[model samples]
Target: MIWWAVLGAGLGCYLLKLAGLSVPPAVLAHPVVSRVADLVPVALLAALVTVQVLAAPEGGALALDARVAALAFAVGLLWLRAPFLVVVFGSAAFAALLRLL
Candidate 1:
């Protein structure tokens, strides 16, 4: 049952992406739409990260903890133009250290 639901959801997402790709080039070539398309990934990542950082699993309430400290390290590293691997590892290490303390 769960597998069926997962398969269906995956299929639905793929079809939606396929539909988006099927859009006419003329419509896609519009300047405003092109700008928006460029920003879509940024917006999606921000939304995904916001949810991950703020949302609680059990109650769906917003809570701050070691994750916030880890996120701070990530942001500072990003601002400093650190490499992606460094940012990721630095944040993970900071978060683990926070948890240990």
Candidate 2:
């Protein structure tokens, strides 16, 4: 069941990526489409961040925890224009300290 779910997700992602590449340059250059396209990455990143930071396992519940703090720190670093590697390492370090405490 898990394998099937993974395969389905991979296939869906591939299809979406292919869809982006398949669009003709002229179509992408259209003012409306271009504006929407520019927003796609930001929207996708927001969605991804939301899922990682907000979702919980089993039944739905809300809690303030170290993982959440780490996520917030990472987002702050991103807002400050920190390099990708620094954000990743800093988040990992923060999470580790939290876990140790």
C-alpha RMSD of each candidate structure in angstroms:
1.8, 3.2
lDDT of 2: 0.88
Name the lDDT value of residue 20 in candidate 2: 82
| Per-model CA lDDT versus the true structure | 0.94, 0.88
Q: By TM-score, how accurate is candidate 1?
A: 0.84
Question: TM-score of each candidate?
Answer: 0.84, 0.68
What lDDT tens digits, residue by residue, belong to model 2 across residues 19-100? 9899889997899998997899999998897776766765487655777999989989999999999999999899889989
Model 1 global lDDT (CA atoms, 0 to 1): 0.94
Model 1 worst lDDT run, 10 consecutive residues: 54-63
lDDT of 1 by residue, 14-42 (tens): 99999999999999999999999999999
After superposition, the stretches of candidate 2 with alpha carbons farther than 4 Å from their true spots are 1-25
